[model samples]
Target: MLSPNLLAWSVELFIKEPGSNKTVFWHQDITYWGMGETDDEVTAWIALSDVSVKAGCMRFIPGSHKGGIVDHEDTFSADNLLSRGQEIGGIDESQAVHSPLKPGEMSLHHGRCFHASGANRSDDRRIGLAIRYVTPEVCDQAPGRDWAMPLRGEAPAGGWSCIAGPRGLFHAADLALYDSIIEGQTATLAAGAEQDVSMYGGTKA
Candidate 1:
């Protein structure tokens, strides 16, 4: 399991050009959270495969979290997450250390950490499981806007509410599914969880 106490988690695979996954961009995680400060979140990244710097591993900015969350940029590219911060003097990339791990290993990071991954220059896919954790204190931002919406099922004791604020990000294919859920075409999150009952990292665990 990734984090026994996951607030949100996903199982994802990264597949880029064959042996050309070396180029990478940088970005912060708080950009996905429509509400609350970056200082209010945390993440646990668990690798399901052997991850190396040369194989598109991730690195972290030294104490960048202390600077608080930077204002998010609208660009959709991930390659700029690293170079942009360095070019703008907001981060020192040279000081970062490439952190690698074996399968079943995990990296726990402060939500505000300045992090980036190398390109997936390898021939194989980069596989990992990630879990985003929160203290149940942060408000949801997926109510309105171009972000996620609410499913019109049974509401909580307080009535139907959002678990995240509107975030202008999506995986394209998943956006339509999300929108449908918002329009009462889906079930509640708790109900979905009960149906699948996945672990913190989207694995059976």
Candidate 2:
């Protein structure tokens, strides 16, 4: 059974505009996350708008997580949504399972699951909020500091910096804090990458 007590590692709001060619290539969430092969993390992808197959809903490979982390190629394609366009080659597409969700509905997947989303062909935007949760035991192995916000039960004792809730909507202090977190995390995500990480724009020396 999954634990009810969890900390929010991160929350990302994805908006794929109508008729957008942006494609999320076949990849695993575990890549470049520095968590190793731990199973303590889960991603709750909540659909803010109707996410249909035509709207580029995410697809998963059944039992792919059992293979653990494998080699990934960084293509850095212009239409790819990933930071590095990291992809796992030789995936049998015929075995993929598409996951479509209605507004307010959510789908959960392990961090190691191989997943990808296609281009949005629908007329409406495909919006979703993905919240990554991790148990207290999960710790970052990448460089620099890491953090998680405690959402339920006792907070973690160490290894992660516990972030506080935002003070106000678009507050200056809160915005600054948000920028700091992104800047710090960019380094960890871009570690060992070939081309400079374009996530923050401008090349990193």
Candidate 3:
């Protein structure tokens, strides 16, 4: 659920294979997002499979959203699922709250919440869908421009342009648009850097 002024910004599926060691590092969603100034964004993480601590369920630092953005370091580990393997510093793991959920269940968190997931140690795979919602008042701050779909209310003008929904999977026009968008996103995420540090707007660790 989102404010009336907000729209669906993006959606992504994250999967952790059974017995995989890949992990999502501790970091705030806003840090990697282009959403500017206003942290008027929320993420709905919907579980597609039975998820638990052993299956790498998400963990959050309660009330951590109020602290604002903090410093992060790129671990560059092969098992890190983050774009840059970015991890927030000085975290007290003892304060973390593990969030386990059944299929179809979901958890909502502010964009600035500190969160992460451990390596999956279960016998079954774990899948989660993360849907991000952002208010039109938020500005895109990444290198390349960004686009968002209007899910509710009138779509905002400027900053992001409107895009038509794909009529079918792998449609020619859709594929072209997808390629163009991916190019822009890759450039924006790369930020002209040669390594994973490019994703971080601050000094590399």
User: Of the candidates shown, which would achieve the greatest lDDT relative to the real structure?
Assistant: 2
Q: For each candidate, what is the lDDT? A: 0.49, 0.84, 0.76
Clashes of 1: 20
Per-candidate RMSD vs. true structure?
A: 11.0, 3.4, 4.3
Ranking of predictions according to lDDT: 2, 3, 1
RMSD, model 1, all Cα superposed? Answer: 11.0
**Could you give candidate 3's per-residue lDDT for residues 88-116 as a string of tens digits?**
88889999999999999999998788999
TM-score, candidate 2, is: 0.93
lDDT of 1 by residue, 101-204 (tens): 78789887876677777766566655556655543334544433212223233322321233543355676655764655444312222222223221111111
Q: Which lDDT value does model 2 have at 7?
A: 89
Candidate 1 weakest lDDT stretch, 10 residues: 196-205
Q: Could you tell me the lDDT of residue 96 within candidate 2?
A: 98
Could you give candidate 2's per-residue lDDT for residues 2-63 as a string of tens digits? 46668898888777888988888899988887788989999999999999999999999999
Pitting candidate 1 against candidate 3, the one with the higher lDDT is 3
State TM-scores per candidate: 0.58, 0.93, 0.89
lDDT of 3 at 177: 79
